[model samples]
Target: MKAAFLIPLLAALWPAHAPAEGVAGDFDYYVLSLGWQPGWCRATGDRRDARDCNPGSGRDFVVHGLWPQHERGWPDHCATDERDPSRRDTQAMADLMAPGLALYQWRKHGRCSGLSAAGYYAALREAAEAVRIPAPFDDLPRDITLPPAVVEDAFIEANPGLTPDGITVTCKEGALAEVRICLTRDLEPRPCAPDARRDCSRSRVLMEKIR
Candidate 1:
């Protein structure tokens, strides 16, 4: 009877331990996150020090990350045999994301992509180029408060193939933060996974003006 009882108990516990280690390049889709530069600088109090936050940077929305996503969950820090990115490799992405972020993303998410450092960064650039930034955000003269859905709608309107279900807007401290869009491995738009479709439900959120 003890053997029978132990067998059921172990079966119950197996699933909890099964997915602790993710397999590289084994994901269902991708999430391309675009951050609002002005909101990030204001929220983080990064005035003149950071390159992207400095005056005359002329940046609005910048690439935050290109994350591999499962249909229901995500992976990170998976074990991989790929070589880590060199300093020069990371620096090449400075125009879109910080060098530190490029390095960190490579170690955490990129390693799980089953791509070499060069291949992963190249894919990141391709993903960023797939989305079009809505024009209104380029010339906002002052702060504005709007529902996060409006932001999602703007992105959908700008990108011909993107839909409301494929994009989400996130908020931070009652301010507009980032927009996350779902894409297939080939970089085509797709509906986000249930767990990944996080919409900021605030009735209105602050969108800081460009500095």
Candidate 2:
């Protein structure tokens, strides 16, 4: 369904009372952010979690979060009522998320998505599947250094629907952290808003090894 139609249809079917922070479904599109796991582990060093840091994990980018964002601002934790995510919903996202991230993401961001747990997660999975990981990035032979723009270009080149403005490269301590891609709620590429576009000021950043 078109995002324009789906948002209003959802709103009418299940009216959401805005939380103290802001109204649910007030956002314009979604940001499907994928974290470079090795960079994350290396940047944090000792603070790394077991799943992502496991030496033989053979993982590269992992789902960071699928966020609902406005053109200029973001709404988070917008649900007035809290409910536990079903185990089925949590398990459905397990392959894409690290341990504990599924729950945290649902509470912190998904609740504000104006979608039921099943619908929201299904959309998230679809968005993640829509993008193709650029070669070498999908499986890096060794740690390499590249400009943030290069990383963004790689993704844009790999994913037919993406443009430079539709994606932003994020870094932490000069290491590639995440690639945040803007998409309409229905999962079509679009330019990220100014707020979502702001990130990683460094001229170059490290792309850590995937072992």
Candidate 3:
């Protein structure tokens, strides 16, 4: 997953300064960032999460986190009413989320969702389940190059209720990085924030193979 590595890398690179406080339930929508695992590992380094990068895993997209977003910038570490997931809750979350990325999401985004720890995570799972991966990406195993708009169109065609405005295709150095989808708090497809749209300006983006 791109954000699976991106968030942690960004956190490491972020300045060691006090972050702004967040206001609970103050956002407009949610952004479910699904990372293209192989694309990230290739850019970051070979020494990546073995479970995800191993040649036989056969997983292309992985849940990075279900983040709460605003019309402009987003929120993080809202009110310190944070609660760690319990053992049982952790097990349930693992069913849909990456283990390492789970805690970061809770601390950074989940805490600001204005829902209980259990409720927030449940929403994370719900958001993930709501989207249907396009057939081309449903079970990717080899690297493929594609145009960002083409990928976005595939996703829109696969998901009946989704539209171009509902999704964005992110790229890194002309490589497909992630596909960010926007959804309402209740999990229905929604248009993404103008700023949250994909940042790639290239005609072709490389999607590294899962291996």
Candidate 4:
């Protein structure tokens, strides 16, 4: 759905920094640090799912970054109508967002995002939607391979109590760096609790289930 506006502009740019005593890091997917999502933010113009009267839309995803800038806002003034940035708590805006921009920046018109040597923030919905298809990269159908056992056999032929987990992927020379999946169902974690998230379609039936 237009990638849903990069999920509320990256939940309003991670302004809440609370974790600095005994230092705990490594939460992965759902916030708590480890910023960035998804390689250059994806979405570079598509718009074809608007139906019903022929409106034709869906493809305006964005998540550009530069958190904690020097007070003036708009990442030190680029447009200034305030695209994103403003809660007022400065340490030079948390030391200018602490990093060298890589992940957050997926636009599709007037300009797009680039640069990601893969140094930081690159989860990218595990590849897309439900997650899976990793390992020597065999699923090469392209257009962004998102085949976790065909979405768990189309959700067990359309919900039959849904029981499908067990994924494991690992490709070498072909590609698909590495991927380990897990599942148990019962989830909804978006913006907040739904059991705090889990069923990634049972982690795409556990990566891609070869075992």
Q: Go through the candidates in order and give each one's C-alpha lDDT.
A: 0.87, 0.82, 0.80, 0.25
Candidate 3 lDDT over residue span 75-161, tens digit each: 898885657777677666776665657877887888888888888888888888877888888677677887899889988998898
Q: Against the true structure, whose TM-score is highest?
A: 1
Q: Using Cα atoms with residue i matched to residue i, what is each candidate's TM-score against the true structure?
A: 0.88, 0.85, 0.84, 0.19
RMSD in order of candidates: 3.9, 9.4, 8.6, 17.8
Q: Candidate 1 — worst ten consecutive residues by lDDT sum?
A: 13-22
Give the poorly placed runs of model 3, Cα more than 4 Å off: 1-20
In model 1, state the lDDT of residue 34. Answer: 94
Number of the top lDDT candidate = 1
Clashes of each: 0, 0, 1, 4
Candidate 2 whole-model C-alpha lDDT, 0 to 1? 0.82
* Candidate 2 lDDT, 128-158, residue by residue in tens: 9888989868778898998899989888889
Ranking by TM-score: 1, 2, 3, 4
User: In model 1, which residue pairs have backbone atoms overlapping below 3 Å?
Assistant: none
Give the alpha carbon lDDT tens digit for every residue of 90-151 in model 1.
99998889899999988878988889999999999999997899998976778999989888
Scored against the true structure, residue 79 in model 2 reaches a CA lDDT of 66
